[model samples]
Target: MIIHVDAHIAYRFEEPTDFLLQMEAAAIPEQALSGPGLTTSASEHEAHISGEDAIGTRAWLRCEGDFTADYRITADIDRHLVDLDALNQLPPHQLPGATVPYLFDSRYCPADRFQSFVEAEFGELSGGARINAMVQWVADNFSYVPGSSNATTTALDSFVERQGICRDYAHVVCTMARASAIPARFVSCYAPDVTPQDFHAVAEVFLADKTGEPGSGAWHLVDATRMATAGEIVKIGVGRDAADVSFLTSYGIAQMQDKRISVTRG
Candidate 1:
């Protein structure tokens, strides 16, 4: 399906600082673009945008005063969500070398601490089923409070607090899935129908087994947030955690004035 996505954000800086913005879409196999997928601010400024990396395009801008970032995209998402039961989790050695590291802990997703809990709850299940159970458990237990969490709240903290935003949900599930021996990573996404429209957070679990053909594996999108289904969402970045996929990182103090994101079927 084709869709249009846009994000506009205004930030007030305390002084001159360097800004790293990441709220742009990348051209991926699943997303066919009409033009350049990510467009930065038009205002003349010293900005350097590196090519899209495994995570996403990161642009550095030096600004002394206030700044505004605007980005838009028009693309078609061509993919289908596979049933969890149909996928088989691959052992670490069988997974692509790049996918192997996500199975371990990150700053946000600390899988080691949850080993005992995961074993007690999901050790009996194998493959996608175990991952699905973890997703469902996260959705069922975590409360979606808009301002309930901060940058310091890790997966363990959210598991104990029982409340957080999409990032927290993704973090907890990533941790649980990793604990269950499934390779999972955080995805920065632009999802249609996101209430209070904003950049969204989701997770993908690498499945070694597909429905047909031998040695077929794929990354399966699993959004415990449940706002947009797995297939329809637009992917931006795939990282070990949110820190690796943050929308913006600034070297100086900056307070948000206003932020808005919108996505619509085209």
Candidate 2:
């Protein structure tokens, strides 16, 4: 599948502010990108940097007064879909260095706190089966309330409230997977099928490869909200939590003036 994305963001900066923006779809092995690239009103102060694990690109910018950014991209997704249940969960000792970090707690996803819950609720299951069940539980029990959560909401909060947007669902899934001794990370992405047509978030779990080799594993995407199909997601980047992959992170105060995002199938 191919996806076309166009986004325009405008903001009012109270003073000179330094910002890190990760909006463009990642140029990973699974997704190929062909486009002119990001444009901004304050191009002089903009520079590009690599995203976490080098999965995508981020922009560093300094601006005052008013700022606007325009980005458009065409992404050809070549990701192969597989059965999550068929994949094995490798032991923590066998995990690669990069995957080990995802097994612990993070700010928005406190895996430590959910250990008991996960054990009681999903103790009977293991590997991808447990992950599948966890995702289903989230889908069945939660309500998709757009403004039900805020920037500070965590997975524990969402679990208790049983309502939130995609980000919250992702946090819950990540937390649960980590609690189950499965490595999981948060993903920032774009999906054409998402209602309201905004940025999307999902969870990526590290599992043993099809061959079930001891130290060979791969990351598989999972969406608890069911808004993003496995093969259709165009990832922006990944991090331990949303804080590391925010579309816009300002070092100083900034207010949103206007923002519009459109993603469609091409």
Best by TM-score: 2
The predictions' CA RMSDs to the true structure, in order, are: 2.2, 1.0
Off by over 4 Å in 2: none
In order, candidate lDDTs are 0.81, 0.92
Model 1 C-alpha lDDT versus the unseen true structure: 0.81
What would the per-residue lDDT of candidate 1 be over residues 68-115, giving only the tens digit for each residue?
877777978898667888678776666677777888999999899999
The lowest-lDDT stretch of 10 consecutive residues in candidate 2 is 36-45
Which 10-residue window of candidate 1 scores lowest in summed lDDT?
43-52
Task: Report the lDDT of model 1 for residue 156.
Answer: 96
Query: CA shift at 170, candidate 1, in angstroms?
Result: 0.3
lDDT of 2 by residue, 1-266 (tens): 98899988999898888999899888789999999768889633888999999999999999889999888999999997889888778988899998988998999999999999999998998888899999999999999999999999999999999999999999999999999989999999989888888889999998888887788988999998898897889999999999989999999998999988898999
